[model samples]
Target: MEESAILNNSECTRKCSENLSAVEDAIYVIGGKWKLKIIIVLQESGNIRFNELQRNIQGISARVLSNELKDLELNGFVKRVVHAEQTPVIVEYISTDYSRTLKPVIMALSEWGKTHKRNIREDAF
Candidate 1:
């Protein structure tokens, strides 16, 4: 609620409460690296299983992926489908409509990062 804690010194305060609330909401949704990556992967792939996701993420540990999936589900960004049949159950993770809303924001950020990297590299060289 305080502008001092929300932003650093020397920064012009304009609608500090609104800006801080937006930042807080963004953090609440995409707080971790894994959550962002998971959302991207699910957005691109549509639907995937635990093992498939883990493989695609490269270095993400099993425990971390599991925890992230649970957190995503809890936050309503992802939907878990459990197929009951034989001994082992098949659980699939799919991006929910709420997560689809973030596609444009994520894609814009991705493009911005690419352009920023290109600019920096050209400046360096």
Candidate 2:
């Protein structure tokens, strides 16, 4: 039997291919070095100024953070609010309710990461 035929006949079926599509779509939206970190910070802090968010993340440049915020806002994951009432005025980025939907995903990733780190340490010894 050929390799392609074996794969087609085995576990890699149409359903699995469809699942790959969903994973790809997810990666397209949220796959990056800074996005999930930014979301996590906003999720924890509620609303934050640009400087605060930058300080929280650490090592991320202002230009990159600004670009990421624009992308997050465009995707409906966060909101940018300008408060004109205060003397100095305030600009804040807030996590949207839509962003809250990622809570389960974040929790799962955290759990898996912790477990993986433990496993790696165990193997090293």
Candidate 3:
């Protein structure tokens, strides 16, 4: 029984390690300085034009925003729509269903950040 328990423990550890690796990979795709920020903006604003997004994000360059949008679209987190019917074509960005799945994650992070900020302020005083 002892030997079997040891084997079970090792198997559990191996499964946890595999899960950890997958979580790391997911973070690698979405864990960036701007990715989550952009996602949050889209979540709040819904479909938004390129220029509008650039203006809203503050401090994000047009080039960087463009690159980040491309990455998000590639990762299935964002959808790009081109309105060619208009005299002047308009391109819009919207968060995809997959991206909506991150709402809880974003809210949790926001809550944690608020608490962290309060903690830092308290410590400083």
Candidate 4:
């Protein structure tokens, strides 16, 4: 029984290691300072024009925002829409349905951030 239990523990560790790789892959797809920020903005704004998005996210250059939007669209977390109805044409970014799955993750992060800030203040004193 002891030997069997040791084998089982080894197998469990191996499986966990494999699962961590998968989790890392998922993070790679969305892991960036700007990607999650852009996602959160799009989620709140629904369909937002390029210029508006740039204005909303302070300190982000037009070039960086464009690149991040393209990356998010490619990753299936965002969709880009071009409106021909506008005179010069209008482009908007919207969060995809799949990206809505991230709401809980974002919310959890927000809660943690709040707690972290409070902890920092307490520690400083």
Candidate 1, residue 19: the lDDT equals 93
**Residue range with the least summed lDDT across 10 consecutive positions in model 2:** 6-15
Candidate 4: tens digits of C-alpha lDDT, residues 45-96: 9999998998989889999999988888888999999999989998888999
Quickly count the clashes in candidate 4. Answer: 0
Error of 4 at 71 (Å): 0.9
lDDT of 1 by residue, 36-84 (tens): 9999999889879999999999799999999999999998999999888
Query: lDDT for every model?
Result: 0.89, 0.94, 0.94, 0.91
Which of 1 and 4 is ahead in lDDT? Answer: 4
Error of 1 at 28 (Å): 3.1
Evaluate model 4: give its TM-score: 0.89
What is the Cα-based lDDT of residue 51 in candidate 3? 95
Question: Which stretches of candidate 4 lie above 4 Å from their native place?
Answer: none
> Root-mean-square deviation of each candidate, in angstroms?
5.8, 3.4, 2.2, 2.0
Off by over 4 Å in 3: 1-5
For model 4 the local lDDT of residue 72 reads 86
* Residue 32 of model 2, lDDT score: 93
lDDT of 3 by residue, 1-89 (tens): 99999999999999999999999998988988899999999999999999999898989999999999999999999999999999799
